[model samples]
Target: MVVRTEWRLRQQSPRFKPQRRQAVSLTSRWIIGLLTAVYLLWLLVRTVGQPDWLTQLPALVSELLRLVEIGWLATLLVLWGLVWWHERQEAGQRLPPLKLEELYNLHPADFERYVARLFRQKGYKAAVRGRSGDLGVDLVLTRQGGKRAIVQCKRYRNTIGPDIVRELYGTLIHEGVSHAFLVTTADISESARAWAQGKPMTLIDGPTLVAIARSLQLSPPSSPKAS
Candidate 1:
């Protein structure tokens, strides 16, 4: 039975290719636009014709306006739902499905480890600090016969503000590190970015993190990493 089904599917493969839907004719579009304009004009004329009705209909108009507001809100909700659904569909198409345990295992610490490994693979001697203490940094990376860099990793769900950047900058100065990097899976706020600008400190946000991961060929986390 399986063999027969396989044979049938193979035979039908060419017939099953999707075809593009035809575009609406220009005549149809013109008719739709004309009808919509006429209906709107008629409504305007009808509303103008009844002055007494209009005077009495303020309450009704208010109620209709409320209903229109509700309709607009519902339309916005539906559009947002559609956008979310499309994003989910695209994500599924672009990546392989992950298991729950695999997702659960993806932690900020794991990301730190991955980054360290990547740096090491690139011939930079790197280490992940288990705790944020007097070490004055999170990841210490040393380039061969080059400057030693200190990286501060901020895994936040929301935007990393200027406060964290300021702290790292202070630490960088205190430690006398040649270079400093503040990395996060989330974005840094405009103020935070501006604050770090021209300060001899590097700020790596979501896009930069993703780019680095791609460059290093690091696997995607099963679950979303904290920003």
Candidate 2:
């Protein structure tokens, strides 16, 4: 049974928060285009009816041609410049695919984010906790049907011991979640694995983490929804 407390409720984070998108109305665009066309048609009619229209036609056409040339040249230059700048930005933002070897080089906070993202991709609603005084909890995951789980990430090269697993178990009790996850970049000690048996906790090591990553890459992920 899970214990419910005010503090535990406050500690719980949301999965994916839904955001409303702002839309532009097609009707408004159509109305504006129609108005512009009508105004241009009216001006053309008024210009053609003038008494001096025939006498001034040559000079008027020459001036209009010059303006159109200048306007088209400036517009083309601006569009070309914008395309070049956008291409440069896209080039700068492109990232290489994640490799298993690179996980060892990531910062602790980044490691936590990576774990959270992996869980999210696997169809869980996951949130990374704040860095300061999180009480050993790195991430909180809420699966379908409102089952909550806490995650702790360890980017260690050395094997994890039972002490750490015991501490996370205590945190799980405090958080009152259905389960807990401990993700590490190294193997769990034999004692640690034994200590976690029959508990509402799962341990994930380096190779397992890579396997999960590869599996997700091969299979399309289901969209994550808030529980």
The candidate that wins on TM-score is 2
lDDT of 2 by residue, 1-227 (tens): 23455334323322211111101222333454565566556457656764565446798785885676567556655655654564344323312224455665565665676676677667776766736899999888888888888999998899999999999999999999989899988988989999999998999988888788777766655654543
Q: Which sections of candidate 2 miss by over 4 Å? A: 1-97, 222-227
Off by more than 4 A, model 1: 1-105, 218-227
lDDT of 1: 0.59
Candidate 1, residue 86: Cα displacement in angstroms equals: 44
Model 1: how far is 91 from its true place, Å? 30
Mind giving the per-residue lDDT tens digits that candidate 1 earns over 112-207?
654554455445556566474654477887765656878877666588899888888888889877778887767789999899899879898767
Worst 10 residues of 2 by lDDT: 16-25
Best by lDDT: 2
TM-score of each: 0.47, 0.55
Q: What residue pairs clash in candidate 1, if any at all?
A: 156-227, 186-227
